[model samples]
Target: MKTRAITGFFFIVVMVGAMLLGAEVFLGFFTLLSAWCLFEFYGIVCSEDRKPNKFLGILTTSTLFITTACYSLGWLEAKFILLFIPVLLAIYIHALYQKRDFPFNDIGFTILGILYVGFPFYCFTRLGYITGDFNHFLPLGFMILLWTSDTGAYLAGRSLGKHKLFERISPKKTWEGFLGGIILAVLVSLCLAYYFQTIPQWQWIVTAVIIGVFGTLGDLVESMLKRSLNVKDSGNILPGHGGFLDRFDGLLIAGPLVYLFLYLAN
Candidate 1:
């Protein structure tokens, strides 16, 4: 318990600190973070006989992320994102020569790593610079809402949970916990609306709702992945936190949606 708490504390610190540091730090930090998460995803899916072209996958993903970062940082135009296409195409071409039985399966999972893990993080970087100027509050607020929702659900579920939310995917989650997350997230959104005038009150509340719903979905999706793979955790890099994927799974699905909403909102 102490180890989990300690790891979580530092995790929060690094996350919050990176955002508060400014645009470059936020972009640089998350760029590496995106790559690490993709690497973990590949590790989970790959085996000896069937495996992704990890070198190409990472190269393609990193290219996409770096291009996204460049655009977000105003170093290049959005058209620079096209640079990822060639590297991505390289994945398919490279797979042909590997002579594996399930080459397409390998290719499919490689791309899945990008869509499932990489693209959302790309959207995440865009969120910080959505307004043409880097404002940390939007991205930071997203994390705060996600963390708050998770905490609320855990507490409420432990105390009042009865009916399971998705027993097949995640046995511990409950409908009661879901509602608890929504309620607390709404409350926190109100406070954010009060303090951060960049976004309207109703919008903040709506963002909270999005985080609660989609974030839980993200957690469940990752849980489903792990369960299918017959693994306990994604990895143990974070000590008690399992792995980067376990810690950031909620962000995976919720992030892209939030980015879309915020992009349209602005």
Candidate 2:
């Protein structure tokens, strides 16, 4: 528990500091982070006969993230993102030369890593630049709500949990915990709205609700992935936190949802 708490504290500090630094640092940090997460994803699914083209996968994902981030920052045209298509095609072409029996399966996992890990981080990066400027508060506020929701759920589940939320996928989660997450996230949204009025108060509340709901779904999705892969954690990169994927899985689903909401509403 102490190790977990320590790791969480440092992780939060580094994340908050990077985001608050500026747009370039924010993009650079998450760009590497997304790549690292992709690497971890590949590691989890690889086997004797199924080996994803990790180099190509990481390269392609990093390219995608960098292009999207550059476009968001107004440093590159939207067409640069089209480059990602060709890189993905290259992954397919590269797989054609490999002597694996299940080449297509490997290719599928590679692309899945890109979509599952890279795309969402791209969306999270976009959150910082959603307002046509580098406003750190939006992304930071979203993360704050996410953390609060997770904390609330854990605490509530431990103290008052009874019925399981999804026993099949995650036995530890409880409906009571889920509601606690939502309630706490909504409360935090009020604070976010007060300080960062980039979006309306109602929007923040809605974003909180989105984080609570979709974030839990995201956690379940990752849990499902691990269950299928027959693994405990994604990797041991984050000490007690498992890996980059475990720490950021909630952002994967919630980020895209929040991005779409703010983009469409804006």
Candidate 3:
């Protein structure tokens, strides 16, 4: 318990500090995180004797993330993104030479990793620059709301849980916990509105609700993956946190939705 708490504390400090530092630090940190998460995802999926071209998977995912970062930073043009087409096509072409069974399955999982882990993180990178200028408030606020929701849910579920939220996938989650998370996230949103004056209070509240709902769904989705794989945790990377995928599962789904919300609200 102490180890988990200590690891989580340092994780939060580093995450918050990267965001507070500026865009360069934020992009570099998350890009590395994106790569690590992609690596972890491929590792888990391939653990069942299913070979996903880890080399190409990581390469393409890293390319996608780096391209997104470069584009976001105005270091590259939109045309540069077209370079991914041939590289992706190379996946199919390379599969023809392998004598392995279910090569298509390998291809499918590889592409899915890019969609599941890579794209969402690319969206997360965009969130840091959503205002056409780099400001720490939006990304930092989002993380705070997400962390608050998770914490609230865990506390409430332990103490007041009665009904199962999703017994089949995540038996521990409860409706009581879900609502508890929403209430706390909404409260945090109100505070974010007060401090981060860029967006209105109502939008922050809406975003909090989005994070609460979609964030839980994200957790469930990752849980579903692990359940399918019959594993206890994704990996043993972060002491008690399991892996990058486990820690940022909420962010994966919530990041894209929050980006959309910000776009529409603006």
Most TM-score-accurate candidate: 1
Best by lDDT: 2
Scanning candidate 3 in windows of ten residues, the lowest lDDT window is 47-56
Report how far off residue 144 is in candidate 3 (Å).
0.7
- Which sections of candidate 1 miss by over 4 Å? none
lDDT (CA) for every model shown?
Answer: 0.90, 0.92, 0.88
List where candidate 2 sits over 4 angstroms from the true fold: none
Ranking the candidates on lDDT from highest down gives 2, 1, 3
Per-prediction CA RMSD (Å)? 1.1, 1.2, 1.4
What would the TM-scores of all predictions be?
0.97, 0.97, 0.96
Regions of model 3 farther than 4 Å from truth = 47-49
TM-score between candidate 2 and the true structure: 0.97
Give a tens-digit lDDT track for model 1, residues 101-178: 888989999999999998888888888777778899989999999999999999999999999999999999999999
Error of 2 at 10 (Å): 0.7
Scored against the true structure, residue 236 in model 1 reaches a CA lDDT of 95
lDDT of 3 by residue, 1-266 (tens): 99999999999999999998978889889888988898999888884447788788777877776776688778999778767777777888888998777789888988898889988888877777778878788889999999999988999999999999999999999999999999999999999999998788999999999999999999999999999988777789899889888999998899999999998778
**lDDT (Cα, 0-100) at 200 in candidate 2:** 93
